[model samples]
Target: MANHKSALKRARQSEEKRMRNRTVKTRIKNVVKEVRSAVAEGAKDTAAQDLNKAKSIIAKAAKKGVIHRKTASRKISRLAKHVNTLTA
Candidate 1:
């Protein structure tokens, strides 16, 4: 329980931010899974498309401060590598 008024307000703001972040993170996970599944099924075209979508979502999350920029870049790089393997 927040004793002070300011503390209660801060708690409320924190809860809102947490929910927003959770939604973004869940979206990121779902897109990444989609990309991975496409890759696993050897659907290069689908994987590539999903990878692009994942990259955009991840980058947006990073820009929104939901995730670290480097972490987002790393995730995008890894997914791209997997999708590229289909080309090789």
Candidate 2:
């Protein structure tokens, strides 16, 4: 338990941030899964579209500090590579 008033306030803020971050992370996972499933089903066009959407969402997440920028770049790169493989 937070003993001081300031500590208690900080704890509350931390809890709120945690919940918000969790939701954003869950959204990221869902979007990534959508792209993966589209790719797995061999829907190249759909995968490409989904990848675009995912890229936007992930970039925004990184901008908001929900994820690291390099991590976002890596994820987008990997997903784009998979989509490109379908065309090759």
TM-score, every prediction: 0.98, 0.96
Give model 1's clash tally.
0
Instruction: Highest lDDT: give the candidate number.
Output: 1
**What's the lDDT of the predicted structure labeled candidate 2?**
0.93
Instruction: State the C-alpha lDDT per candidate.
Output: 0.96, 0.93
Worst 10 residues of 1 by lDDT: 44-53
Per-residue lDDT of candidate 2, residues 1-88 (tens digit): 9999999999999999999988988988999999999989999889989999999999989998999999999999998998888899
Question: Model 2: runs farther than 4 Å from truth?
Answer: none
lDDT of 1 by residue, 1-88 (tens): 9999999999999999999999999999999999999999999889989998999999999999999999999999999999999999
**Cα TM-score of candidate 2:** 0.96
Q: How many residue pairs collide in each prediction?
A: 0, 0
